[model samples]
Target chain A: MPTNKPSLKGKLPTELKVMERLALVEQFLAKLKVDFEAAGFRRNRLVNDGIADGLNLVSNAVELLAEESYEDADRICRVAWIRAHFARAIFDAEMTEHFLGEGVFLELDDGGTTDWRTFASEELAELQEEIVNLRKQIKDRSAKRGKK
Target chain B: MIDDVAKLLSKWLSGQRSNKLMSTVVEAMTEARQKVRASDSPFKSLARKCIDRAEDAYQEAIYQLKDGEPKLCFQHCKQGLKYISMAMLHLSDLNGNATTFAIEQGGADESIIDLSKAIAAFKTSVEYTNCEVTVEMKERLKESVRLFFLAVSFVEREDDNEAKRCAHGGLLYVYLLSKESEEKLQSNAVDAEALERCHGSAISRIVSLIDELSDTNSTLQEASVESHGRIKLYLDAARRTVDRCISAYLDNESDALSQLAKAGMMELRMARRLIEYAKYPTSTAEPEEEPIEEVDQPTDNFRGRVARLQRLLRDEDEEVAVVRRLGVVNTYYSRARALFASGELSEAERYARSAHLDIDFARQLLLDKHATYSDLI
Candidate 1:
C-alpha cells in the first residue's frame, strides 16, 4: 500500500486533474479538426462565419476556465453550442434540398400539388393500397385468434 | 379597316345582354310617371315606383336563379329588399297621418307608417335618404347585399364551410335590421304593431334560413379534426374580413374594400398552412438531447474550458489567437468525446459538430492571414 502504485481510492490533486482535463480537451479538438476536413464543411462560407464567431466565444471561455471562473466559462460555451447548432441545422436543410431536388422539398414543405391531375391519380392509388393493407391486417389478426 | 372595326363593335354590343337593373329602373320610371299623374302627391307615386322596381328586380332574380347564377340572383334579391324598404318609407310619408296613427295604435299592426320611425329603426337605414334617405342606411344595405351575394357564390361553389360563414354574416345584418326596427318602436319612432304587420314575416324567414345553414355547416365541420380546423379557420377569416369591410364601408372606400377582401383571402390561405401544421405532428430522426437541461448545472471542467477559450480569443497576436481559438474548439470536442463514452449519442453529436465548425473557421482565418479585424468583425 505504501508503494508508488496508484490507488483507486486516492483522489488526484486539483492541479493534476485540471491538467488531465486540459490535455483531453486538446486531443478532442484535434479530432474535430480532422472530422471537419473530412466533411468538407470548410468550403461553406456561412459555416465558416459561424465557426469564427463561435471560436471567439470559445476562446473567451477557455481563459475563464484557466482562471477557475467555471460559471462564466460554462455560459460562453453554452452560447457557442447554440450558434454551432443553428449553423449545422441551416447547412443540413440546404444539403437536403441539394440532394433531394427542389420540387420534392416544396411538396413536403407546403403540402401542395404541382399538378392536380397527377396528384389526384397518385392519391387514389395510395388509398387503394392502404385499403388492401388494412384488410390484410384484419385478416391476419382474426386468423391469429382462431376466429371463425 | 375603320368600317370593319365599327361593324365588329356593333356585333359585340348586340350580343351583350342589357343590364338587368337598368331595365328595371326604366320600367319603374315609366310607372312612376303614370302614377304621379294619377296620385294627389308625388311622394306616394315615387314610393309606388320603388315598389315596381323592386318587383322587377325580384323577377329578374328568379330568372337568374333558374339560369344557375346564384350570385346574380342574390344581388337581385338584395335590390328587391332595398326597394321594398324604400316603398314602405314612401308610403309612411304619404301623409303625416302615418306617424300619428302609429302613436295612437298600440299593437304590432301595419297601419303605422312613419318615415322618421323607419329611419330611426336602423342606423344603416339613416344614411340611405337625403331629407328622404340616410347615407348610413344605404351603406348597410350595400353590405347586406354583398354578404348575401357572397353567400350564394360560396353555395354555388359547393364550399359549405365558406357558405355557412357568409350566411352567418348575412344573418347578423338581418338581426341588426330587426333590432333597429325594435328600437324605433321603443322610442315611439314607429308603432310596434305596424312593424309586426310590415316586416315581421320577412325577417323571420331570413333568420330561419340562416339558422338552418349555420347548423348544417357545424355538423359538417364536426365530422373530423381536420374539417373542424378548416371550419374554424374559415370562420375566423370571415370574421376578420367582415370587420375590415365594415371599416372600409365607414370610410366610403368601396374600391379599398375589394382590395382588403382579397388581402383577407390571402391571409386565410396562409392560416390554412398553420392549421395543417397543428393537425399533423412532424417526425425527427433522432431523439433530442436535453443540452439545456444538462447546462443548468454545468460541471467544473466545462466551466474551466469555457474560461480558457474566452481568454485565448482575446490575444492581440493573430497567431496566438488562432491557436487559442483552436484550443476552444478542442475543449468542446473533448466534451463530446466524454459524452460519447457515456453513450449519450445525441449530445455527443451535437458537441462534436460544434467543434468541427470552430475548427473550420479557425483554418479559414489562418489561411486568410491578411484579413483585418474589421473583416472579421
Candidate 2:
C-alpha cells in the first residue's frame, strides 16, 4: 500500500474552501471541454453573460451617484460593491453569463436617490458659512474644484 | 522532536528567505514599471542594486541552510527579509496599491484570500513553534510571524468603523501567540488578564481616539469650554492606557526577543491604524461661497475638522501626522472655496496659503517621523 500523504487541507485557511469550489468548476470544465469546443465555445470570446445584469446594477449606481441620488446612491453603493466583487470572480473564472440574482444582489429598500442638485439652501448656506470661518486656508483647491 | 523542530524552523526560514528573493523580483519588475509610468530614470539604479543584493543573499541563505548552520541560516534569512522589505518600500513609493499583491495572484478575491493565508501561516508557525526551537530561534520565528501580521493589517479599511472592530481582532491573534509562546518557554500559566488588558487597551485607545476626534470637532463647532474639556478627558484616558501597555511590555521580564517581537507587532498594528486614519475619505462636497466676516464663526463641521486635525497631529506617528495635516489643508481649501463664493477673496487667499504651507510642513514632518522595523534592529 502507498504511504499516506500529509493532509495539507486541515492546515489551510478558510479561504482555501473557496479554492475547492473553483477546483470543482475546473474539474467540470475539463469534462465539458470537448463538448464546449464542439458546441462552438470560442476560446477567444470573452463571455460576460449575466455579468451585464451585475454591471447594469453598478452602472445604474454610477448614474445615481452622478445624479446626486444620495438615498438611491447609498443603496446602489452597497450593490455596486457586491457587483464589483462578483464581476471580478466571474472574470477570474472566465465565465460569460454570470449575473445579478436575488441571492447574489442583496435588496435595499426602494427610496428616492439623493439628488445633488437638491442641497437645501439652508444646508448649503450653513456649509458656506463654515467655509468662511476656516478662511484663507481652503483657497488652495479653487482651481482644482473650479470654484471661481 | 529536535529534528522535527529543526525541520520546521528550516522550512519557516526558507519560506521567508525565498519571499525575500521573490520580493526582489517584484521590486525589479515594479521599478521598471514605475520608470515606464513616469518616464523617470531614478528608480532603475536602486532596483538593479536591490536585485543584486537579493540574489547574493538568496544564494548565501540556501548554502547556509544546506550546511545546517541554523544561526547563519537565520542571519541570511534576515538579509533576505531586508531586501524584500526594501522592495516593498520601493513599490509603496511608486504608488502601487496594497491590493496589488492579491491582484497579481490573478483574481479579485485573491487579496483577501492571501490575507487569510498569511494569518493562517502565522497561526501555524506559532502553534508548531512550541517545544521545538531554542529561545533565539523562537524569537526569530516570532519576528517573521509578527511582520506578516503587520503586512496583513496594513490592508485593512479604515472608514468602516465596523471594519476597524474586525481588524483589531488580528491584534488579539498576535497577543494570543505571545501568550502561548510565553507559556511554553516559562512553563508557567500565561497571564490571561495581561493578554486581555493588551487587547482591551488597544480597543480603548482606538475608540478613545475616535471619541476625542468627535469631541474636538464638536467643541470647535461651538468654540465652547465644555467641548474642550471633553476632548481633553478622552485624550487623557486614551493616552494613559496606551502608555501603560507600552511601558508594561518594555519593562517585562520576558526575553528581549519576545518582548521586542510583541512590542514591534503591537506598534505595527498601531501604525496600520494611524495609516488607515490618514487615508479615510471625508465628505467631498464643494462648499458654496460665503462672506469673510462670517469666516471666523465656528460651525459643527468646522469643529469636526479641527478635532480630526488635532487628533491626527497628536498621534506620535510622524507619517500619520504629516498626512493628516495635508487633509487639514484640503478641508481649509474647501472652506476657502465657499468663502470666495461669498466674495471673501482676502480670507480665501489666506486659507489657500495656509493649505500650501501645511502641505510643505507635512512633508518635512513625515521625513523626520518616518521609521521602519529595520530602525529598531
Candidate 3:
C-alpha cells in the first residue's frame, strides 16, 4: 500500500479517464487560430484609434462572436464575461446608465442571435418529470417485493 | 333503457368504422364521464369504472407513442379502443341510457388501406373534401389518418420503395400540418382540443418514424433511405417553424422567440446524421458530430440593410439602391458557405468569390459616391 504504485480505488476507470482527457483535448484542439489573429487586430485598433475607435474595435470583436462558428462561440462567451467585468471600470455611472440602458445589453444580446432558454427549459422540465416517474415506479416495485 | 344504450353504442361504434379509434374513444370517454357525474344510480358505478379504464388505456397509448414504441402504442390504442367499445356496451346495459343526439355523423373511418393506398386515398380525400369539409375537420382527419398509416407502416417490411415513400411523405405532411396548428395554438388562435389532436398526431408519426429506423430488423439501406427522406421533411418543417417564430417575434417586437428556431435546427442536425451515414456506407465509426444548435434563420432585413448603407454612404437617396447590392452579396456568401459545408468545395469557392466580388463593387460605389454617412466609414 505504501509503494509508489497506482491505486484503482481513487482513480477513474481507464475508459472514463481516457474519455475525460479526450474531451479536454478536443476543447483545446478545436480552437480556431483566426480568433487569436482577430484579437491581435482588435488590440492594435484600441491602441491606435482612441476610445471611440476602441468601441468600434469592440463591436468588431462582437461580430466575430456572432459568426456562430464553434471556436467563435467559445471566444464570444469569454469576451462577454470579460466585457461585463470591464464595464464597471471604464463606464461611469451616467455612462453606464446610457451604455446599459439601451446599448450594452442590446449589443450583448445581438452578439448571440440564438436564444435557447425557453426550449431548454421546456425539455428539462419534461425530462425531470420522466425521471421522477421512473423513480416512483422503481420505489413502488421495490416496496412490493420487500426489497431495501 | 338498456336497449336504448345498446342501440346508441352500436350506432357510434359502427360510425367509427370510417373514422379514427382515438377520436371516437376520446369523445366516448368524455360523454361517459359526464353521464356518470350526472347520474346517481347504482348503474353509474359501472359506467364510472369503464370510463376510468378507457381513460387509462388512452393515456397509456399516448405515453407509448411518445416513448417511440409504435407497436406498443398500437397495442395500447387497440386496448383503449376495446375499453371504449366496452364502456359503450356497459352503458347500453344500463336501465335508461340513450344518447339524445343523432349518431350518424360522417366523420367515420371511411378510408382504410395499406401504406401506398392510404397515401393516394388521403390526397384524394383532401382534394374532394376541400369544398365540403371545414378547415378544422380536414386538418384533424388528415392528421389522424397520417398517424395511423405511419404506425402501421412502421411494423411492416420496408423492402418496397412505394410503401416507404408513402410512409415518409404521409408523416412529413402530417408533421407540417401539426406544426402549423401548434403555431396557431401558441398564438391563442386555436383551442386545446384541436391543438391536442394535431400535436398527438405529430408526436405519433415522429415516434413511429424513429422507431422504424431504430428497429433491430431494419437494414442499413432501409434506415439510410428512410432517414434521408425524413431529413428533407424535417428540415422543411424546421424552416417553416422558424419562419413563423421569426415573423411573429419581429412583427410584434416581442420577447426573443428565436430559441424555437434554434431547437428546430438542432433536431434537423439529428436527422442530418442519417444523410451523412448514407454517404459513407462503409465507415465503421459513428456519424459525424452534429452542428451546434444556432438560430441561423436568415432574415432579409431590408431596413437594417438601408441603415447600414446609410452609415457607409454619402448620398441619402442612393442608400436604398445600394442596399440591394449588399443583399446580392450576402445571398452569394450564404449559398457559398452552405455549399462548402456540404463538401462541394469547388462550387463553394466559386460562390464565395462571387460574393467577394459583389461586396467589392458595393464598397467601391460607397467610396466613389462619398455617401452622406461616408465620414463614419
Candidate 4:
C-alpha cells in the first residue's frame, strides 16, 4: 500500500509546511500525468494542454531537491505553486476558448517571494534577535526621512 | 534667407510688441517657408517642417493674445521662436552659414547654471504630479541636460553656431519648466497627498486582511495560506522597492524613483487583490460587506499637511519662523510612528512628545499671525 503524502492544505504555512507542500504538488503532478494517460488523452491536444508546460518545473524541482539545493528548489516550487494556483483559478473562471501556458508561467516568474512567517522554532528566536537589530535601522531611516 | 527669419523670429519672441503683431510674425514665417521652398538644400524638406511648426505656434500666440491670456501668448511666441531657431540651426548645420537666433535669456554659462537650478526645481514640483507626468518631466529634463552638455562641448570646440543653437534649446527647456513649476506650485497640493494615501491604504489593507485570514476556519485556511504567501511576497518586494526609491531620492535620480514607486504600487495592488480573493473565493458579495479600514487616514493626514504647508509657504514672501517647526513636527511624528510600528513604545513616545510640542507651537503662530491660513494649522 502507498503511504499518504504530506500536504499543506488546511495547515499553517511554515518552512517545513512549504517543503511538504512542494512534495504534495510534485505528487499531484505525477497523479495528473497518470490520470491523463489512463483517460486516453492524446499527446498534445488535451483540453488542459497548457498545464503540460508546467510539468517540466516539477521535474526540475525534484532534480533540485535531489541535488540538496533547498533554496533553488524552494524558489522553483514557489513559482510552480503560484503558476499552478493562478492557472487553476483562470481555468475555473474562464470560458472554454481561453487557453493557459507560457503567459501564466511568465507572469509568475517575477514573483520572487519571501514567506515572512516560515521558520523553524530555533530560527524564529534568532530572527527575533535580528528584528531588534533591524528595528534600529528602521528608526535611523525614519529619523533621516523625518529630518527636513 | 534663414538669417532674416531667425532675426524676425527673435524680435517677435521678445514680447515687446502688441499681440496683434503676431499676424505679421506668421506672415514672416510664411515668407520664410517660400524661401525654404525655393532653396535646393538637401534637408530643405526637414527645414520646412520646422518652419511649419514655427508658423503654427505664432498663429496660436495670436489667438491667445486675442483671448487676453498674455502669459499664454508669451509662451506660444517662445515655442514659435524655438522651432524657428531650430530650423535656423538645421540650415546652419547643412550649409556652413551661421544663422543664429538670439534667445531671451542668459549666456551659455549662465544658461547652463540656470537650467540646472530649473531642472532641480522641476523635480520637486514633479513629485506633486501623477506618475505619467513625472516620467515625461524626467525625459524632458534629461534631453535638456544632454543639449546643454553638447552646447558646452561645442563652446569648447569654438563652434559658435552649434553652441548657440544648443544653448537656445536648453534655455527654452528652462523657461518652459519654470512656467510648469509655477503652475504646479499654484495647483492644489491635494493631488500629491492622494497618491501617497493610495499607497499607504493599499499596504494597511493587505496587512489587516492577513491578520483576519490568520484566524479563519479550517475550510477557509488552505486558501488563506495561499493568499498569505502572495501578500507577504508582494509586501516584501514593495519594501525593497521603497528602499530603492529612497536611494534614488537621496541620489536625485530623475528616472528611477518614479518607475520604482510605480512597480512597488503595482506589487501592492497585486497583493491586495490576492488578499480579497483568498478571504472570499468566488464570492464578490462579501467584500462589499467587509469594512474597509481607515487606519492609513492618519498617515495620509500627516503627509498631506506637510505637503500643503510646503505649498502654502511658497506663496508667502516672508519666512514664518514657526513654519520650520512644522517640519520638526512632521519628522518627529514620522519617526514616532515608525518606532511605534516596530514595537518601540517608549522611544516612540519621546518623539511623539516632541511632535506635540512642535504642532502646538506652529498652530499658535499660525493663529496669531496668519488667521487666513488657520485651516493648515
Instruction: List the candidate 3 regions with Cα displacement exceeding 4 Å.
Output: A1-148, B1-318, B370-377
Worst 10 residues of 4 chain B by lDDT: B97-106
Each model's DockQ score: 0.01, 0.03, 0.01, 0.01
Ranking by lDDT: 4, 1, 3, 2
TM-score of 3: 0.19
lDDT of 1 by residue, B1-377 (tens): 99999977764453232245445545655564455456564256445655676667768877876775655665665556445444444444334322111111221111211211232233222222211323433434334433433433333344434433433433345343443333242332223443343333333333333333333333443344655654454544443444444444323366776675555554444444444444443642322211111221123233333332332233112366556655666566567656755756566666655655555555456566533322221
For B64-117, candidate 2 gives per-residue lDDT tens digits of 767766556555555544444333343333322211211212121232232233
| Candidate 4 lDDT score at position B149 | 44
Measured against the true structure, the TM-scores of the candidates, in listed sequence, are 0.19, 0.24, 0.19, 0.22
Model 4 complex DockQ against the native: 0.01
lDDT of 1 by residue, A35-141 (tens): 44566622454345445655565545544554556545544443444334323433444344444433122111101111322332343333324323433443454
Model 3 chain B, poorest ten-residue lDDT window?
A: B101-110
Which is the leading candidate under DockQ?
A: 2
After TM-score superposition, what is the CA distance of residue B138 in candidate 1 from its true location, in Å? 43
* lDDT of candidate 4 over B74-103, digit per residue (tens): 666655654554444344432332111112
Among these predictions, the greatest lDDT belongs to 4
Candidate 3 C-alpha lDDT tens digits along B127-179? 33232434533533343333333332322322223233333333344334333
Q: For candidate 1, what's the RMSD? A: 39.6
TM-score of 2: 0.24
Model 3 CAPRI quality: incorrect
Question: Which CAPRI category fits model 1?
Answer: incorrect
